[model samples]
Target: MTTPRYKRILLKLSGEALMGDQGFGISPSMIKYVAREIRSITDIGCEVAVVVGGGNIFRGIAASSYNMDRASADHMGMLATVINSLALQDALEHSGVQTRVQTAISMHEVAEPYILRRAVRHLEKGRVVIFAAGTGNPYFTTDTAAVLRAQEIHAEMLMKATKVDGLYDSDPAINENAAFIKHISYMSVLERQLKVMDMTAISLAMDNDLPLVVFNLSDEGSMLRVVCGESVGSRIDNVTDGKNRVDRTAAVSESYH
Candidate 1:
């Protein structure tokens, strides 16, 4: 049996990751795949919490670019996140994983309001808690919401699930010679503006001393390997600020293969 490095973690999943090749709304197969991966870790006695984004359904910042009121756009984005959260909860339950959906904004009909004690209690009872609605406010990204919830729940670390394998010096999609980074420091991430996560999210994680792992979600068993402390992706921590960062050799690969 493989022991996990962190007993409890907050897994951040982007809504876009749920879209599959359709490039639009939710893909049932993709969501089920994600649910099964999450269950793999939970079955091994790991406490998991999730914070899902709303980009696939709606993007507040993108709407604001078209002169829409920022607040209204953001609110709509929050509702979109709720839709994804419910879908995720259903998938996890079907996979035999006990799950709960809690929203920052009160949506009593579907999910319980986000309460710190109740959320923690759910994790203690081996139930995965899905946090939706993004802080119950506008103009904040789900990335920030994930950090906040992780801190509130005292999660050991935050796992960011992306299509890419790990952080890179450049956008791997455009640059063929982009370098993959194996390890980085929080301060370095902010100073270099690596964009693995939003600045607000990075700063919060830095201040809280919470380590973050970024890895490819589409790859089979990647999440389980990460939880088990395998070197499957980039790890960002408080190591020496900027003196020692591991840079993988430049390689060419499709963004999602």
Candidate 2:
């Protein structure tokens, strides 16, 4: 297998990944497992940063089905990330990794506010910094926050750890015959509206030339696979203002098959 191409990577993990097989909230065993994977990456010489989503506990926008105010709902979502970040910090520490949880919204009791320089300093010192609170504002998903933070920290790539292995032409879970694209362009992603991520997030990543490595976090060694430059999932990078570019040296296919 080919090695991972990135030196400093910002991993964007959805809260649902922490849920494991549970219906809601985090599973201790699962968190520990994920933390171990991250530890493996850091053990190699790569600086790892994380932007965790709070979807498992709450997604303010998705909660519109209940008619909650969009801003209030988003704030609640931010709070949920704080909870998740704390859990992850504890888990990482348990695995012998020093971590710091930084939030956009100030919660001095639990973590430091999201200060870009401070977070970068932590990474420089070899500490895993968990960015929480989704940009410290409402009406934005954590996906956008991930792009913004990843860009600000000058992360070489964004390792998007999702339930799915990679971007697909159709819903792989629902459509058995869906095919995964080994490589795709930004125009293709938007022209098709593939729903890999929001336009704002993708645009930001595109402008900054930050690659998005979409992979499955549920697997045992996916995180290491991403760090080691192995063929594990789909990578989005604008070759010429592109969106998601697959690694040419590795098996860059999605698991929709």
Candidate 3:
């Protein structure tokens, strides 16, 4: 048995992750696999909340290149997030994991509206809350929404699931020799211009003294390892205006296999 580092955590999954190896659209197999991984965490008694992105279907900022209205495009992207949320909800329930989808915009027909206090109660009862629709506002990315929800829920940490295993000084796939950061300081990440999250999201996390851990969700058990007191990838914490900061390398172990 192992003690957990964070009792409750907000896991942010990009819509692209749901796409998996299919290259486009939701990959049924991949969603189930990911849901199983999430189930493993809940089985261990850690409350988990997920904030999903809509980039897989559409991206508001990307459409700005064309004649699309920025606000309208962003709203469309938000709707895309709801689609992903329902997909995840179905997959998770099929895996026998209790799940809930809450949107920033009130769409009671599809899912519950985002109510911070209510979401916290859901967690207390061991339900996984999926926050979709990206803050129900334009110009705010899902990354920022994750930060906001993590704060409102008083989450112990934020787990950002990315294509890469952790944060790197440069692009990992393009740069084979790029160094992977097992841990980094929040201020340093901002000062040195590391691409973890957007400035707004980073600022919120910094102000709240919330540690954000980056890891590869493609790998099995990575999320579990982080919550159960295992350092998987780069942990960004400690800011000049916030709490103390430190960095260290984490060896691969059961912290998550």
Candidate 4:
């Protein structure tokens, strides 16, 4: 058997990815597909922990921008994440993967309260852990929660699943001249104002020297490829090893696929 690159990893999935082609709400088929991909890695002895977002059902920031109280909106967003977490848990169990949902908020009826030791225990027992509720606080993105949980669990790296293949100098969908960055420094990401993640999350990961791999979740087997150390996404860390960014027009197909 080929050895995997990272024995354990934290995957950050935006709530939007759960929507599939739908404009809003979770898609059952989509959740099942994600569960299968996750199970595939676990079958190879790779431990997985996931932190999911809640933008599909509710986005606190967007609601607050419309005049709702920011804190209340964010709390509502947190509930949305809990919903996604439960759905994912059910799907994983159906796929025969042992799973646990630990939430920041105290919800004994649904999930266990977030406990660092227990969460680690679940992973050690070969069960996937799904972290929900976004730190159980307002004004924080799921990105930040993912980083925090990853550090607490001592995950080898954080995998940020997104709609795009990887980070680019510009929005690839809008800019034909965008550049594909295969490897980048965390400082460079913040300096360039890349939208890979929120500044707080990026800074937190940078301070702790946690490497992040941003890749497209829609592509089949993309997650497996990333865990295998294939060059499928833009990797951000403290060092670049003297690699130059490639123009998207020249390397988009080769690098992303």
Q: Judging by TM-score against the true structure, name the best candidate.
A: 1
Ordering by lDDT: 1, 4, 3, 2
lDDT of each: 0.92, 0.82, 0.85, 0.89
Q: Which stretches of candidate 1 lie over 4 Å from their true place?
A: 250-257
Name the better of 1 and 2 by lDDT. Answer: 1
Which tens-of-lDDT digit does each residue in 1-257 have in candidate 4? 65678999999998988988788999888999999989888888889999999999999999999999999999999999999999999999999999999999999999999999999999999999999999998988999999999999999999999887788887766666678788888888888888889999999999999999998887889888888888888889888575546545532432221
> Under the 3 Å rule for N, CA and C atoms, how many clashes does model 3 have?
1
Q: What TM-score would you give candidate 4 relative to the actual structure?
A: 0.95
Cα TM-score of candidate 1 = 0.96
lDDT of 2 by residue, 44-158 (tens): 7678889888988998888876898888899999999989989999999999999999999988988998888999999988899999998998878888999999988888888
lDDT tens digits, residues 1-257, model 1? Answer: 77888899999999999998877999999999999999999999999999999999999999999999999999999999999999999999999999999999998999999999999999999999999999999978999999999999999989999888889877777888788888889888898888788899999999999999999898899999999988888898898755656676765464532
Between candidates 3 and 4, name the one with more favorable TM-score. 4
lDDT of 3 by residue, 1-257 (tens): 55667899999988888887776779999889888989888888899999989888999999977989999999999999999999999988998888999999999999999888899999999999999999999999999999999999999999999877788766655555566676677777787777778888988898889999999887788888888877687788883455433333332321111
TM-score to true structure, per model:
0.96, 0.90, 0.91, 0.95
Candidate with the greatest lDDT versus the true structure: 1
TM-score between model 3 and native: 0.91
**Higher-lDDT candidate of 1 and 4:** 1
Which 10 successive residues of model 3 have the least lDDT summed?
248-257
List the pairs of residues colliding in candidate 1. none
What lDDT score is found at residue 18 in candidate 1?
A: 94
